[model samples]
Target chain A: MIQAQSLTKRYGSKVAVDAIDFTIQPGTVTGLLGPNGAGKTTTMRMIVGLDRPDSGTVLVNGQRYQDLRAPLREVGVLLDAKAIHTGRSARNHLLAMAATHNIPTSRVDDVIELTGLTSVARKRVGGFSLGMGQRLGIAAALLGDPGILILDEPVNGLDPEGVLWVRKLMRHLAGEGRTVLLSSHLMSEMALTADHIIMLGRGRVIADAPVSEIIGQAGGATVRVRSPQATRLATLLAQAGVTVVNLEQDVLQISGITAAEIGDQAAAAGVALHELTSLTASLEDAYMSLTKNEVEYRTGGTGDDEFGDDDSDTTDAAADAAANDDPRETELQEAAR
Target chain B: MSTPTTLAAGTPETLADIGTEFVPASTPTGPHLNAIGIIRSEWIKLSTVRSTIWCFAVLLVVSMGLAAIMAFGLDLAGTDIATVPGTDQARFVAQASTFGVFFGQLIVAVLGVLVVTGEFTTGMIRSTLTAVPKRLPALWAKALVLFVTTFVAGLVSNIAAYAVTVAIANGQGLHASLFAPEVIFPVLGGALYLALVAVFALGIGTIVRSGAGSIAVALGVILLLPVVLQMIPATWATDVLPYLISSAGVSMFGLIQFAQVPLDWTVDLIIVLVWVIVSLGSAAVLLKRRDA
Candidate 1:
């Protein structure tokens, strides 16, 4: 468990990480989702002992990270892909990190193969592509087979196959009851990857709960009813204290009601219900809604919503759907191999 | 395998029958990430960087190269003049060996600049601090490794230059051996002075954390500031310059010190020590306070 108590970081007059308190549970993949400058990186840096918090403390396991004897083994952190020296081969880089913990050279080789960098392990990181550099970073992170893993934007440069491989890897690591805390602003990716989400908008966590629960709460359940008597049905739902929003000609979006409830209401009202569906908000929508007010660097406000990330959601969903096709994760590991 | 003891996260829940909720996060994991470990890691990292190797090689080349040419040139000029005052052909050749320490120190300063600056450039400083956690040990280890390596390397090169110069002078009919009474102090002092100055520069690099800033500051302290001080009417410059690491170190090479307050051998060593200690102390403090 990695716990940060009232962690705060300030650079001159600007506070980067404002006295935020959070904990990363074990045996779970907790996603730290936030905008570009929303203090996610600063919080991670403080937790891992890279940056000292001005007021507060971060504890890895029970003791502070600095107090840990075998920090690399206790908690592995992949701060960024470029953290390793570029001149050294991936193997040497891992070896050097391994040497810190007195871990054997064979373990370095094991992580190298684990991260699928065995083929390119001997290549200098300077020559490796961004994807390969990320792989090397993963390999280094796993060198100690640490109990907790902290990764900042771990899947940034991975290919589709590599991304799937990472998804499985995180799941597999979490399955083993290890703690994995990762940060990503990609809401769809977080939805697919994280079991729990901590949503940050500008250094403050707006929502912290199960990913599905957050999705349901922030973007309340909306019931879509298409009927010959849309206006009549809208009146009924509004009378029942549900806000009704009209979209197309005969469609009415009703909140605070379910599809089944709407069907019953329409049937009793003698409305010919051609179509009725409950559109629950996605994790992305929930995130955008909560962060809608606090996006520090808002591009524009005039659009339908600042985060009309439907395209990104579709792609990520498509990728997740494909990965989920084979219930047998064996295929993924095999394909990854 | 024993379960790794970590803090209970988020919503608290009872663990087992024991119900040991939050026991301040125990570390069944062994040794503390102590200062010594940080120092050891710093040593390995400093050694592995290619900048270290290249800079030392440059120090060797320039310092020894100066000795070789100076010895040959001085010996060749002494055909008519058998002896010149307190300086003879042999003495001049021995003295020739020590001139390069000044230039050699500058290159070492550049080497020191790269040591800390390279970490910033590559963003490895974050990783380093994460490993060590308490940032002071990292700085201390750097100063320890850099001072030792730069010092030893500087010393070896200086001696090698002296030996090679003696050989060249012998060939030119002016024999001066490394074992001579007057030979060891000047040559060894030259080497020690360069190494100490490099360490002084390294501390500056650690505090500044910039390649350009560190080298500029170090060079200015040694070379430029002294000139400015000398321009003043007060003879304080004469007293102050000798106590400066560079000046005191250089005086160790010359037979008759020109500076009014020429530091004795003990005073020169103390001055060098002061520069290293004070600069490194500032660096250590700065490192502890700053974010990685």
Candidate 2:
């Protein structure tokens, strides 16, 4: 278990991680979600004691990281894939790290095999690709078999197969009652892997809850309606707490009302309907809306309205389609197949 | 706990359903962080790198080669070579054996800087600091390993140089006992000075935390400071020259006298030691207080 209280860090005048408190428990995977430069990496660095907190304390397994008897045995951290020396081979790098804690060579070989890096363990790290380097970093983190594991961007450059392997590995580790905290900007991956998520925005905690709760709270269910009388149907469905948008000629996107209610109202109003489908928002859509104001680097006001306004139909429709093309939908389709 | 244990052990089919690839990670059982383990880790780090090997090889070759040339190129035509005093002959051979240390000091300085700066430049320092979070132990282990290894290498090179000098000078009627005080003391002292110079450079490397910048600062203090001081042509400059690191270091081995009044070798060694202490002390402070 790891506990932090009022943890704060600043680089000069700019605060990198504002005062935040969190507790990561064992037996589950906790994903730290954030945009670029949102202090996710800084918070992880502080947990491992690589960066000093200006105002608070972080305890790993009930002790400060520096004061632990054997820090590697208590917590394993993969801060970045480039933390290894380029001149050394993967095996030698692990061996040297193992020597510091008196860990044996057999354990090093075991981790090398566990991470599926035995084929390239003898090669210099300078020549490894980004994915290979990430595997090596994971191998190093698993060298000690610690009670807690913290990885920053573990699946950053991984292939689809590699991404699946990491998801299974994280679940397996947590199943064994180990505390696992991983940071990522990919909400779809987190939606599949993490049991809980803590979202950060501009050095502050924006939301912390279970994955299902966060998604449910961020987005209300919306329904897509198709009819020949699109204008009449939109006017009929418009009411208090309800939003209707004319998506092209025959479709209307309605929110704050269920599809059955829309269908019944259309039938009672003597309007013919071609299609009515309920659209449940994916985690990606929820993340976009939750962090829309917290983004540090906005691109040309493109992210101003995630649901798109009525003025720009083509661009907004394209953005909305892109947001809905999430991996959870693909997984659902595959399960159905 | 009892229910989960029963579920895990009761059904083989359930276990197989989770996939056979999910092997349980074995618990790590080992001793905690200790001085011996850290020192051993540092030794492995030093020996595995190519730069250390290259630097040590160059040091050995330069020492032996310079001794050979000095022994063969001595001018003995104007004097009766056989009639020279036995003590003076031993001093000549000892001087030749240790002359290469003058150049070897610069080589080890560069080696020392690279040992720490290589980690900094490659981002390996973060991994190292994370492993030993107290931070100072890593620096201490590195210094101890570098000092001991450099000392052994320096001793070997000086002895090899002495052997080459004896072999060549012996044919020319110059005979000196290897165990003689004049010959042995300077040989041992030269090795000591070389080892100290490497440690001094290691401290500078930690402070600067950059390869090129640390090398420039270390070499400037060791090589250029004395020259610049000598060119001042003042009495205070003359007095301060003896206290400079390179001047005192070379004087410690009796290789050269920087002061007009030549002080004792022990005093020169102390002067060199003070410089090393100051450099390492400040380095430790900065390393401990700064974020990795």
Candidate 3:
């Protein structure tokens, strides 16, 4: 288990991590989801004692990382894939780390083969590709068989096969009753691998819930209705709890009511309904909405005329929906507490 | 496409039927890490790097090779020491046999700087610090390993150089005994000086995380400062000149002696040690307080 209490880090005047608190329990894979510069790496570093928090404490298995008698056996951390010495071979790098814990050489070779790095174990890390480097980092993290494993961007530069392997390995490790906390920007991967997700934006926890709950809470099903009397139908569907967006003169996007309800109302009102389609929000849409306002660096509007003004309107509607959603706002407040 | 049933039928379903023993039955419990384990880890790190091997090889060849060249080129029988009023017989032989110390110190110092700065350059320090999160043990272990390895290298090279130089000189009808204080002490001091130079460089490397920056600073203090001090045209500068790092290092090995020099060999050893402590102490403070 990993617990961080009010952990805060500052680099000069800029705050990198702002008094965030989280608890990661065993027997499940927890994904730390954030955009670039959202303090996921900084938080992981503090957990492993690489960077000291200005004020607050992070503990692994109820003990400070530095105070653990055998740190490697208790908490295994891979903060960066390129953190290994490039001049050393993969086997030598693992051996050196194992030496610090007095771990046997047999365990070193075991991790090497387990990670499928046995073919290039004797080659220098500098010559390895980015995917190979990540494999070495994972091998080193597994060298001690620690109860808690922390990895940052483990699948950053991997092929489909390697990505699948990591997904399976994380689930396997967590299934064996070990705590696994991994950080990633890949929403699709997280949706498949993560049992729970802790979302961060601007160095603060914006949402913390199970994968299914976060997807459900982002936005419910929406119905797209096309009719000659779209304006009348929109007026009829307008209520205190429902959101209605008029995309065109004959089209209406309605939320907080099902497609059956829309069809029933249209039939009762004698409105000529051309089509009614239901759309479910994906995890990508959920993440984009949650972090719409927290992005640090944004590109300027190019004003490309090829796409016309319709694209900008759709983006604005999505952002508005994310900001004004009531259930998500309440959940954000609760997570902050 | 091969079906799972067909593949299973062709192979035995036992654990040994697999081509490799990839997984262990259980996590192996090993001995907990202590200072000894850290030292052993440091030793492996020190020995595995190619740059470190190159540096030690250079130190050995230069120290031993230069002494032989100087001893072979000397024509002792062609000149009378008494005719040269200020020339001391013992000092000349000791200095001649250890002429390589001047060049050897720089190489060892660079090795010292690389010992720590290499990790910073490659971003390996993060991995190192995470493994030993207390942080001080890693520093202490690196220093201890560097000190011991360099000291042994220095001792072995100095002894070999002295023996070779004496043999070459004996062939030219000149003699020096290994038991002579002038001969043994200077040789011993030369090794001690090289070891201390390496430790001093390690400290500077820790303070300056960049390899080039630390090397420049170490070389400046050991080589350039003495030359700059002489041109200052002040009595105080001249008085303080003997206490400089290079001067003290030279005197500690009994290679140079002057009446105006404030420190004798014994005091000079302490002064050089003080330099090591100050450099490493500040490095330890900054390392512990700074984010990796």
Best by DockQ: 2
Mind listing the fnat for each candidate?
0.27, 0.56, 0.54
Q: List where candidate 3 sits over 4 angstroms from the true fold.
A: A220-280, A296-320, A323-337, B1-30, B77-93
lDDT, candidate 2, at A335: 31
Q: Which scores higher on lDDT, 2 or 3?
A: 2
Which candidate would rank higher by DockQ, 1 or 2? 2
Q: lDDT for model 2, on a 0 to 1 scale?
A: 0.83
lDDT pick, better of 1 and 2: 2
Sort by lDDT, top down from the best: 2, 3, 1
The candidates' DockQ values read 0.23, 0.34, 0.26
When 2 and 3 are scored with DockQ, the better candidate is 2
Regions more than 4 Å wrong, model 1 = A119-124, A220-280, A296-337, B1-40, B76-93, B253-258
Q: What is the TM-score of chain B alone in each candidate?
A: 0.82, 0.89, 0.84
* Model 2 share of native interface contacts: 0.56
Model 3 preserves the real interface contacts to a fraction of: 0.54
DockQ of candidate 1, scored on C-alphas against the true complex (2 decimals) = 0.23
Using all chains and alpha carbons, the TM-scores for the candidates as numbered come to 0.80, 0.84, 0.82
Show the lowest summed lDDT stretch of 10 residues, model 2 chain B.
B1-10
Screening candidate 1 with a backbone cut-off below 3 angstroms (N, C-alpha, C), the clashing residue pairs are A62-B25, A69-B31
